[model samples]
Target: MPDSGGLQSVEASQRPDSQVRVFALPPRDNAAATTIVDGFLEALTSDDPSYAVARKYLTPKAAKDWHPERQTLVLEDGPRPHSTDRANAEETGRNFELTGTQVARLDDEQAFQPDDRRYKGDLHLSLVATGKGKPKQWRIDTPPHGVVLGKTDFQRIYQSVNKYYYAVDSAAGSGAAGAQKRLVADPVFVRKWADPLTETVKEVLAGPTRWLNRVVTTSFPLKAALRDGTRSLAPDDANKLTVPLNKSADSIGAAQCRKMAAQLLYSLRDLSSSSVDEVELERADGRLMCTLKEGAADALVAPRYSEGTEYQYFLDAKSRVVRMPASGGAHPSPEPVAGPMGEGERRMRSLAISRDQERAASVSGDGRALFVASMVTNASLGDAIAHSGAKAEKDGFTTPSWDGQGDVWVADRDPKNRRLLVFGQGQADRMQEVRVDELSDDARIEAVKMSADGARIALLVTENGRTRLEIGRVERDHGVTDGDVEISVADLRRAAPEMEEVTAVSWAGGSRLVVVGRESGGLQQIRYVQCDGSTPTGQALPGLTRVSEIAASDTDLPLLAHSDDGIVRLPAGAAWQAVVKVGTAPVYPG
Candidate 1:
């Protein structure tokens, strides 16, 4: 990941650490072979394409054979002391012992997979006499075969950024089976200070990363790239950019040209201090082909969560929907939502609201039934839609989650039907079941939240006595299922491998997530993690005494967690406050 000066919505004063260390220079010592091993490992993670700094500690032959890209082992914590054995000059130099808690690995192909376990290894090196008359110098005779980093360093150094790509268009021109072209986020990792505009286009032209290959597309032609000799695409006078395309992008139509602009505009919108409001494409000779405005692109590629008037919604002591000032004002008297679910005996175990906040979904106290209603205060609880068709023994449901497209998802915890189901716009009859058997035969989803942008779903699935966070990409096709448009979820992969037990999760930003979990031998914590399962090295939600349930939205403020102490919120730069002392399960509009 390049250190392009990119933007983040999360403010710094709220986090304990603002940056993480990615690589370090070798700490040289002639007598300590362990120091040589530590320096060698750090150099492998460095951005040097040729692995030069690391080579200073390695023999030329060893450097030539070692491939840093072969694998990246993510260890549990920061550096630790390695035991070294004294050497006798005649035999092998000595052996330095290394140990770690490895939570994940990225193989040679850059494919990331979870490997939650402990590792112990030895580095055999020599403290050899250069010549009979010279003092002996310690040098590494063997180095680890792959890159390895402790989890803390991994989070601090790498941040995930999403670049835009054309939607998997299921429908084409003139009513082709109810299809439309939209934008989907293609997440990539870059260092904390990457140049957003230049790096983004370069990455897009470089094509999708290994994880999302073929699942997305860009309008740029084959072998197309950001033309050379261009210093920057940022406009000096206004919020518009004119980007020069490589010669391969010479042949494109008007629609394709606009699509290209949409890709750029959306990709650049997440910059922390971006002024770019429009994007235009041009031939290498500087002929303008098409232009797109910020407003136009936003309408086409909806936000992960709608940025509406910020309101803090939660379930009061009486299990009713209520709201308070999001940024903390004179506390408004907590009031029930505009519907029957907010009153009556419809006690909610948990609640989820739509991005627009015009509708909501709730589960019963016993978790046996799911309900949905309009946001209007007068909507009757009796009139709320109910999902049918669950097997009698499998009637339990988890908290419902709403997506940008107005779909609500919930899991049926019934052992017989251990499946995830989606309800389109709260229509019970259109319920569609999603198969996730690959997660495990006994895996049952406990909690789930759909991303605001409709890209991924964060789920807490318990299998084989352990619960972990998995990010599931929603799969759709032209085919219909159970009277609803076809939608299934697969590609479930571990994110936050260090947390073996996850209780809750929510989208904190487009490419990031907030989760409630505990690391090995650690207390329960609320931490920020990337959607791809990567996390930034930072403090957990500050000033909260305890949290049982947490709520977050890109639509509203920072974070809210339901605790025994009360419903507390961590407003940026402020201590957690019991915002609404009466609410139990809390949530923001998705």
Candidate 2:
């Protein structure tokens, strides 16, 4: 076939039970330098478990020194091979420069570090003579360290997995052993088709990454590791997994041992086919220590809500708080909540329910006063816990969000008195002013949403008249007693970097957010973005118009949004259906 404007296509097919595999071809006889360089790059992105085929393209010394696991550089569009000026028809050795726009780097810890810079690396290939009548062959003598892959190829070759760790209760006295037993997810990338079982387990023993280490604690004992030279981990025919620890963990108690097993079970939950049903731990002497079954482990570390969300609340046309069963039928009847805000004594512009669903916080229609009241009883609206002096409603307090720790967070958008405030768990009398560590001088928060685990927070930050979404780590320092607790938001990173403007955002699931925004000069669209700023392919949902606010639960339930046509709900694999004729600010318990 003739060349057609440098365009080409390849068709792939496979059975439903099988997966698609990519292979790398070995170097051919009398191959040119370009072929050797290109073939080695292709092999780095293939399914070779140990990259054995890629090593065949290099010299013996280069092959022995190359380490593919050291790092992975991801480029915008795979590397481009350019023949250097040093290469000509006369030289036996040739040099080539691989160039591209580097987008990110996957370090040895399997953590993806985002980057944007130009990349240039040198590869030298030499021709070697054959012993017999065969022609000489070109081989890579000096190759770049580790591997380099394109964005698309990296996504295809690697997968995202979350390793569970217990959240550190800074409000409690001290030490992780006494902290709350809440599970926090630490995400990392591993090979999709490679020995993921062993790879993921190894990451667990290595402990959490630096960014998340301050807020989480792992069950793995110090210096605890897999037994000497142990590999090829897999469940037996009866769906039982046995893990043997090194000598450092031989003296651990039964309770700590079970916690270790629970961490392993949660880390491997995303594996295909749910192959593991039970986990057994063994000491260095091969003696059984503790065992945990799938059903039993659920009691120890379960989802956000064991029983599920009780109700979803929103504001009716009268600006009164109303509620319906969260898991109700397509159109469940909406009734006012049992509180003064629901009784129409005070009209609220927006509201947030605590994680326990026992208390509610409502902002007045003018957004100047924020009241906290009991949801279980018909209690009168209490005195304002927070007040914004800004006269304009748009410049007053934003919606409040509650974390699992019972703390309420809200931002005062008044340009003159901009501040982020937090109301402590039991201290309603004291409204603590929070200082965001790295926030810019001109930036102001438009909205705030906290994760259920109380480890991370999402903020719609506006700077220079453009609003963007950012994720920050919640750090708490309780000096000696609960009254001396200090909180600060640190390490802010863009969650949706490509969006030019973000209007509404919500935590859709663990480490995922449903964001409503638009690109530069583009129409508004709804998309799902990962906490690390990587947008998964095909994650965009059906388009909806005039979406003022959006809400999603941690569990995989229907998505509710307040759009121009009133409240709309999107069930799995279904279009946006009408939830009510008129409503606004639909939300589930955080």
Model 2 agreement with the true structure over 1-590: per-residue lDDT tens digits: 77666866856632211245678888887777888898999999888879999998998788899998989999988899888854345667888899999988888888776777999999988877645777778888889888998888887788777787888775544344433367777778888778888788888888987778877888889887899978768889998988888998988999888888888888888655347888988898999999999877777764585147877889898887888776667777889888686786877888888888888887888999888888766587768887799989999899899888788889998878999998977246757888797898899999999988888889999999999998888887777755487888888888788799999999987778899999999999999987877776656699999898999988778888899989888888888888787888788876
Quote model 1's TM-score: 0.76
| TM agreement with the true structure for every prediction | 0.76, 0.92
Q: Give the backbone clash total of model 2.
A: 0
lDDT of 1 at 225: 75
**Tens digits of lDDT, candidate 1, 219-244:** 77788776779755575577888888
Q: Cα RMSD to native, each candidate?
A: 7.5, 4.0
Q: Which ranges of candidate 2 are over 4 A from the true structure?
A: 1-18, 87-92, 128-136, 173-180, 480-483
